[model samples]
Target: MRHRIKNSLALVGSIAVQTFRGDAPAGAAMPRFMERLKAIGRAQDVLTGDGEVSAQLRELVERALEPHRGGDCRRFRIEGPDLRLPEASATALAMALHELATNALKYGALSRDDGCVVVRWWVQADGSGGELRIEWREQGGPPVVSPARRGFGSGLVERALAAELHGRCVIAFEPAGVVCEIRAPLPRVAG
Candidate 1:
């Protein structure tokens, strides 16, 4: 319990310290930050108490986006194989998704009524077990513009998630919307 509490505090503190507080008012940012914390909680909720085990990837993605659905479920489309991910990887991916979704709500697709996001994943046969690839693409939103500075959110989504999953993550800011692609080697001994 103590360890978990410490970790939870550290994670929260890290985000507060690392997040880029722009010219936006606290009122506008508070809800987004709260949503992010809720996403982290949902991610942790999926972890089995047992030693490093697995959980459904689809579930994690759904829960991360649940708070953003507002009234219409049609805003987000999630399509992926029924695969399980290790607890750590699952948590990392969930966090990344939360960040992506928060950004969308504030500046991208979810900001517009007609915009939507697609979450898709697939597995490729590698020499070993296989490789998992997850894609997050937004469409029909405001014109996408890359941030002038790479914020901590991008670092967490790209570098932190890649490290946790032992894979690569790339986020693209196209004119249409934002796209995030992540690829990682499937753990040899999956749960």
Candidate 2:
């Protein structure tokens, strides 16, 4: 428990340092940073709830996307079996989901009237808890083109989340839309 709190604080501190050191305009950076912090806080709420160090994967996804969803049920297709994630994996995955949903709203599926997103996950059981597989797919959006350089959100989702959860994240910008695939071991211990 002590280690979980320490590590979580360390990760949050790292995020704060990186956020302020970036080149974003002063007006834009603070709001974005606060949103990220809020996303983290939502994940922490699940992690610390009722003496359970694990959280429902579905609930985490919903909370992460809550700000961007705006009560539009038709734009999202979130489905998966009930699976519980360890604290570190839950936090990292939630942050990654929040970034993806924000980007989708601003520039991808959620930006268009005809577009939609689907989020699905499943678990593969193992002796060391299990392995989690999640997919985020966008459809009917504008033609996709890969960015010339990875941005902060990309770095956070692909690199930081991977390190924090000891996992792998791959994002593909297909002409049809954007797809993000995440796979991680379900370690009971906090990373």
Which candidate number has the best lDDT? 1
Writing each residue's lDDT as its tens digit, candidate 1 over 1-191 gives 56656866887876765553677677776765776678778888876534445668888898889888997999999998888887668878888998898889999999999999999999988888889999999999999888999876799999989998999999999999999999999755464
lDDT of each: 0.85, 0.84
Please write out the lDDT profile of model 2 over residues 73-139, one tens digit for every residue: 7888899997778787788889888889888988899999879999998887888888877899999
Instruction: Give each prediction's root-mean-square deviation over alpha carbons.
Output: 2.8, 2.6
lDDT of 2 at 4: 85
State the lDDT at 6 in candidate 2.
Answer: 98
Which residue pairs collide, candidate 1? Answer: none
82 in model 2: Cα distance from truth in Å?
A: 1.2
Candidate 2 whole-model C-alpha lDDT, 0 to 1: 0.84
TM-score result, candidate 1: 0.86
